[model samples]
Every structure is written in structure tokens, then in C-alpha cells.
Target: MNKKVWLIYGMLALATSTWGSAFIAGKYAVLSFEPATVAFLRFFGAAILLFPIMWIMVKNHTKPTLKDYGLFAILGLTGIAIYNICFFLASKHAPVIKSSLFIASNPVLIVLLSGLFLKEKITKNNIIGMIIALTGVAFIITNGHLLTLFQLGFEPIDWILLGAVVSWALYSVVGKIVLKKYTSVESTTYAVAFGTLFLLPFALFETTWQDVQLATWDAWVAIAHMSVFVTVVSFIMYYQGIKEVGAAKASIFINVMPVSAVIMATVFLGESFTFAHGIGAVCVLTGVYVGTNTKKWTLFKRQNKLRVQTKDSA
Candidate 1:
């Protein structure tokens, strides 16, 4: 409702849109490039694009310590490098909608993990919100066919995607600590750089020089979109939002991703959106409202109190 919250909401919305559209982009990219290759190029492009901005920031601001760099490295490796690689592999075996649904669970996982590790309070509202969100995600993913639950079995790609989710959750948790010590830009830049370094060897192993040359124009365009919009800009916005709002509240925005992805798929990829998708969208929106709005009103009241006190003192 306030300026900061509005800024965070705007950033989260932008990040969600970029990431949602990335499914279509990534699908096209992998058509000509290997998964690892795409992952490598994506991060490499981000690193290249962000390098100048990081340089300027580092020059004008204080540099982070070696310890901070280590944290950034870990965040980058898990969040960017591993998550992208695993996601690409997962897309190979599943529908993009299904994969996006699985990733939507990251917010719930974050809440649970935060409660366990960071000692964050998990209130009744949190539980109810998570259930609603998960239910919506399930509905969207399963297309209202709850009976398919029995028929659906896990594949290797599923495991890879599961790993990606776990890695991303860990990244989110650890990033909270890292952000305390470094600027969001510094932390993001270093982590992305480290992740790019880790991805290079894997990309080399999976791709050849010929594969690079063989890529089509469409693949190049997809790679550019992923690198510039999704990887670099979206990540910047995401971290900015996370800094403005705490990680728990910031993560609720992920629920919007599936809805965005569905819309993008329908428009660009011509994927059908059924009644189930509409119902799932409602559920996700409802859950996000419940989860984000519970403590928000209280927080807003506290902010008003602080502002009034400051004015009185002045």
C-alpha cells in the first residue's frame, strides 16, 4: 500500500512476467541447443551484460569481503547454475505447464524451510495460505484429473526438477543472510558470476563447437530473451523486491508465475487454457492474497505509528 510495498509489488510482477514467458523462450532455445549449452549461454550472457553495471557499482560503493563473495558463490551455484540446468532437463520430459506448477511449490517450501532454519514464525494464516496455493497449483497441473495422481509416476526429469526446487529454496534461505552483508546488486552479480563459472565445464561436456554454429535464429532469440530479460533483469528486480519485502512475503509472488505462464503459452505457443486453468488461477490469486495480506495490515499500522512518532519528535 505504501511506496516501498508498491515498488516491491511492481518488481515482483515484472520478474514473474519475465520468468513466465521464459518457458516458451527456453522451449524454443532447447530445440537447437543442448540443455546445458542453453544454461551456459544464458548465464554467460547475463554475466557479460551485468559486468559493466557491477563494475560501476563496485567502483562507487564499498566492496564486499571475501566471506561475502563465498556466500554469493554458493547462492549463484545453487540458484542460477543448478536450477537452470535441472529445469532445462525437466522440460525435456514434461509439459511446460506441469514443470511450472512444480516450481510454484517453491514458495511453500520456503516458508517451511524458513520456519525450520531461520526460526521464522509460521502462523495459522501461513498454513492456510500455503494449502490454498498448493491446491491451486495442483489443480492447474493435474488439469482437474485427480485420478491421474495414481497413473502419474516420477521420471528422472522429475527428480531433476525436484532437485532444482530444493536448490532454489536453499538459495533463497541463504540469500537472506548474504543480503545482510552485501548490497543486492553486489550479491546478485557475484553469485551470477560464480554460477557462470561453475556452468562452463558442464556446458563444454554437453556441447560441441558445431552445436553452437548449428543453432537457429529462433534459438538465438530465445537465448537472448532468457539471458537479458529473465536471467539478468528479472533477477535484479527479484532481489530488489526481496530487499524491500522480506523473503517470505516476496516469495508469494511466485504463485503468479503459473498464471502468467499459462497466459503466455496460450497467446504465443497456442496452448489451450481450460476451465481448470481459470479455477487454478483464482485459487492462486486467493492464496497469494491470504498469505501476503495477513501480516501486511499489522505492518502498515506499525509504520504509521513510527511515522507519527518521528513527526511529533521533529
Candidate 2:
């Protein structure tokens, strides 16, 4: 409505677009480095920058208790280490667009997990949307051969991408607990620090100092982009959008991610968009919209209208 609001919207869009591009950058990074190494490098770089930023942004920071350390470790493991490892591994095997689509479906899983674990309410729309979104994911993964999933089972890369999605959902669910105690920036910074530590041994096992030194500039650039833009800057901007617009309104910008990923993959990676992708994208996006906007749906509107009319008649 106003200039500031428009600017916030722009930042939100740009943040999501950068997230889409992270898949592309990850695809490039995994071409040269092992998945563990690539993940380690990206987060290690992000951790370096995030600590100082967190320090500056969050004043009156108290010392972390032992429980806080444990929580941070869990966040690091689920959201950072495991998720990124699976992501880079999947990037090595799957198309970036496909990977992005899988990640885009994360909200469905988050909603389900929240209902189960957080004692949150699950509406009929949530169930219907989950079914539709999963159907789309099946189509995308099977290349529209959904029927064969029973006979053929999932591809290994599909499992890996699913792992990433589940890990991210868990990260978000756990983050709800952590955020109640700490600011998002503070929690994220500590989590990234611990995640970097967790990744170190695996990175060392997979690659030596010589190997790290020999990594191509393209790989370095990709890791840098993922660390600086995708992880840190995008998170900040998205959080800002949430602060200004409310989470539900800000979340609508996330739909732009998979679409942007498709476009970026086409333009930068020269990847082809398939018929299955088109169909799957439609289903997933529509399902996500419905899943998130339960109160805004026609049935709910009609129900509200009837209630209002009944009240007026009385």
C-alpha cells in the first residue's frame, strides 16, 4: 500500500529468489567437492559471518546454559548438518529444479509434524492439501509414472531429497521451542556454530587441505553465494518480512521459490522443464495455497457469511 510496505515485499521476493538460486549454486558446488565438504564450507563461512552479526544485533546477551547448548546442537544437526549434507548429495544426483520442488513441499510436512508433535490443530484443508502436495511430489519424482511407484519404489535420490525435507521440517518445529527462549538470530547463530563443528570431522574425512585448496573457483563461488546470500542474507530479509507482514502473509512469497528455481535452472544450468514438472508444479503450488489459507477458502467464507446472516436475522 505504501513505499515501505512495497520495499518489504521486494525484499521478501528477492530473499525467496535467492533461496531458489541456492539449489543451482549447490548443484555447481557438488560438482567439485564432496557433499560433506561442500556443506561444511558453506556453513562454516556462514557461521563466521553470522556470529558477529548476531552479536551486534542482539545486545544484553546472557551466557548460554547447558540446556541451551544442547538445543543448539539439535538445531545444528537437523537443520544445518543433516539437511545440507542430504541437499548437496541430492544436488549431485537430481536436477536443481526437482530438488527445489521437493524442498518447496516442506511446509506440508511441517504442518503435519506440528500437529503430531506440537499438539497443534489440523484442519480438513490441511489433510486435503497434504494429499494433493504428496501426489504432486510423487508425479515429479516418478516423472508422472505414479502408478509404478508401488512396483518400482523410490529412486535413491528421491529418498535423499525427502531426507532433506524432513530434516528441515524438524528444524522448523524444534525452532519453535528455541525461539520462545531466544531471538531467531541468536538461535540461528548458535545453531550454525554447532552445525559447523558437527560437519568438521566429516569434512576432514572426505577431503584434505590439498583437496580444499585445489577446489575450482566455480566451486568456491558457489559455496560463497550459498553461505552469504542464501543462508544469511535471505534469512535476515525473510525474517524482516515476517516481522512486518505477519508469517502467513510473508509465507506467500515462498511460492515464488520453486518457480524461481525452475527459471534459474533453465537459464543458468540449461535444464529442461518437462511436462511432468509443469503438472507437478501446478498441483504443489495450488495445494500449498489451499493448505496455508484454510480460513480464506470458499467453504469457510460461506460458513462465515451464513453465521453473519443468521445473526442479523435474529
CA lDDT of every candidate: 0.78, 0.90
- Cα RMSD, each candidate: 6.8, 2.8
Per-residue lDDT of model 1, residues 1-314, tens digit only: 78867877988988977888888888888888777788889889988988787777566666767877788888988988888888888655566766776676676566667788899887766677678876776676668775565589445666787788889988888887886766777777778889889888888898888988888999999999998999778877887788778766777777668778767777887777778767766776666556556687458768999999999999
What would the per-residue lDDT of candidate 2 be over residues 47-164, giving only the tens digit for each residue?
Answer: 9999999989889886789998998999999999999999999889999878888778888888889999899888888888888888888888988888889999988898999999
| Per-prediction backbone clash count | 0, 0
Give the runs in model 1 whose Cα sits over 4 Å from its true position: 1-12, 58-66, 237-256, 296-314
TM-score of each: 0.81, 0.94
Model 1, residue 81: C-alpha shift (Å)? 1.7
Provide the global lDDT of candidate 1 against the true structure. Answer: 0.78
